[model samples]
Target: MSGPGDVLDLIRERRAFTRGDVLEITGMSRMTVATRIDALLEAGLIIESGTEKVAAGRPSRRLEFNTGHAFVIAANVDTTHTTVALTDLAGRVAAEERIEVAVADGPDVTLNAIADRAKHLLADGRIGREDVAAIALSIPGPVDPDTDRPSQPPIMPGWDAYPIPDHLKAALDVPVLVSNDADAAALGEQRVAHPGSRALCFIKVSSGIGTGIVLGGKAYRGTDGGAGDIGHVKIAGHGDLLCQCGARGCLAAAASGRAVARALVDLGKPTASASDVGVYLADGDPDAARLTQAAGRVIGEVVATMVSLLNPSEVVLGGVLASPPLLAGVRETLYPRSLPRATRHLSISQSTLGEKATAVGLAAMVVEREYSASAVNAALARS
Candidate 1:
């Protein structure tokens, strides 16, 4: 009884399908299936491969969504650098570029540099603006859901309530969706690494600490888009340090990459940022190891409380601080502290996407938003 549009919805939702599979799943007639397939194929929304092996006589051709028909421009903008990538509908980065732009310089300069980098990368990849279906942008700050603007983000001075979406849209001439960097990374991990899991909690420990949560296979942006702003959670008895967010004894204030750097400085070592700390750790510096481990313990305590409450199946540690020793420290504190039921099924692991996770997650957002059943149906109907 389902129509071709309904069948297409199933395919889009599942990301792949075959004619027989569609028929059986949707309970549609053979003629209806043929008509829908013809329409989808003609509309350039789906592609038929050689065949799928069933049993004996012959294999029926398998149909798949065509990724080449469109692409997404994704950017991950941090306080110290920006990484731009062009990805197809399949979430594969076709081209990427990294630029060191100080976000404190002002939004205009930083955003302009990013837009230019994106333009050059797209041209290098031979993908035109029309071929770019959408733009997914990740910023190292909290976003206001209603305004689609950056909130009073820490460290990146002079970018509060900035109209980021409008600026990027004007530059790229495409639809743009913006989100917090940690949230975007969470979505990326969900799409690429753990597609089967329905819920996930991604904790990013970079220049600052943050958390991203995905529920039911979608990023859960809380009211005002600040659900996972765990960086400001207080750590008892650590009241001397000042956080960039103007709070005292906040998690990020005491245990972020910046905090690690400060700890190293206090130990009489010259250090700049967390990346430098990571290099030191990699070079086997004992002091760096000690400071990072301490930071990890603090982060793990927070994560343990989160796990106990959310009961997520997986807890992914990411960003610059998710190093080996840091992970060990988190495990050292979390497993013993969290509720038994919550910690029992929890599989803690480092992020597989690495630094590019947010950029790729941005691309995934574009694909999910622009290539949905209704969008494809509208395109097919127009054609």
Candidate 2:
């Protein structure tokens, strides 16, 4: 018979299990299985889901993860918009809301909007205050991991030294975790799309250009949680363009979504944003294609440097402009620029999680930290 510890391990590893199934799988006696199941149920780590079938008997009861036992709030805050979602332990979005509120106005205004949206989503989802386990927030800036605060938010003019975690905690009465948006997206991709894979990098090419580095299955935030701020790396001879961070000829200034938009405008085109560039690129506009390809080349040069140094297993392209042309541009530049060994094993692919990556990553952070901890502790106690 499997020990109590073995049964708990099985439940934790496999997500959920039924008594008969557990008995067969764990090769445990019926009484021992029933005892362990009873303990887990009493401890609220597992729930009963009515019944199933056995041999010539009445019917066995089914079991599944109790999603309602806890909930998490995830927010993905971008320059142009904010997305809020209420998710359960199973990662299903119970309710979601999006607002056209820009996060560049400062911490006070943006965080208030986020708080309101979160409250509304929670109310709409019918989740009570006590049920919320934690709140994970993604900001489009570097976050001080130790303090969980925004540090020198360059694009966001008034968010410097803002106590984001404290502010959100005060507003929502729940524990809050703040991470860089690109980093969060990378973590989300790892958890939701590329589970068990290590050494991956997610390059976000939206309004700005940023990279998120994950080494050994953990988000590597460097010395001050600003390791992946590649947008500011200067490009040779492109000293005319001014970046929002006040740097001239930075990668972001030369090749971000905003850069593409500005380039199109300079070329006498009537486009306003990177999304517009995507539209034009899809339509095969020569100017848009030309500028996007150029941006991709510049970005690819920077990424090739990274690849040569880190040699990550996979490099995922994401954000609003990770199209074929852009990726082709990246591949075109990276293959020739990077070391032969680095390029040999590298797999460059588009983000499978898309726009939901940040939100999903935030939710995964909450689920992994909050529910998984409780579940594991409860299971251990039962054992």
Which predicted model would earn the best lDDT? 1
The residue-by-residue lDDT of candidate 1 on 1-383, one tens digit each, is 33345566667667436787787776778888899889877767778888888765567898876777788877788878887888886668878888888777888988898899878877765677888888777888888878878877766688889888889989989888888999899988887888887779999998899889988888888887887888899998788889988879999998899999998898899999878887898798888888888888888988999898889987888987777778888888898899899977788998988876776677667767777666666666676
Report the lDDT tens digits of candidate 2 across residue range 1-383: 33444455566545345676787886767888888777667656577777866776668777754556677788888888888888876456777888888887778888898899888877755677878878888888888878888777778888878888888889999988888999888877887777766788999998898888877656888878897889889989789889989979999998998989888988899878878887887788888877787888889999999999999888899988887878888988988999899878789988987877777667656655555544555546655
Q: Pick out the ten consecutive residues of candidate 2 with the lowest summed lDDT.
A: 1-10
Candidate 1 stretches with Cα past 4 Å from truth are 1-6, 55-58
Assess candidate 1 and give its TM-score to the true structure.
Answer: 0.93
User: Cα RMSD to native, each candidate?
Assistant: 2.1, 4.6
What lDDT does each candidate get? 0.82, 0.80
Question: Which consecutive 10 residues in model 1 have the weakest lDDT in total?
Answer: 1-10
Predicted candidate 2, C-alpha RMSD: 4.6
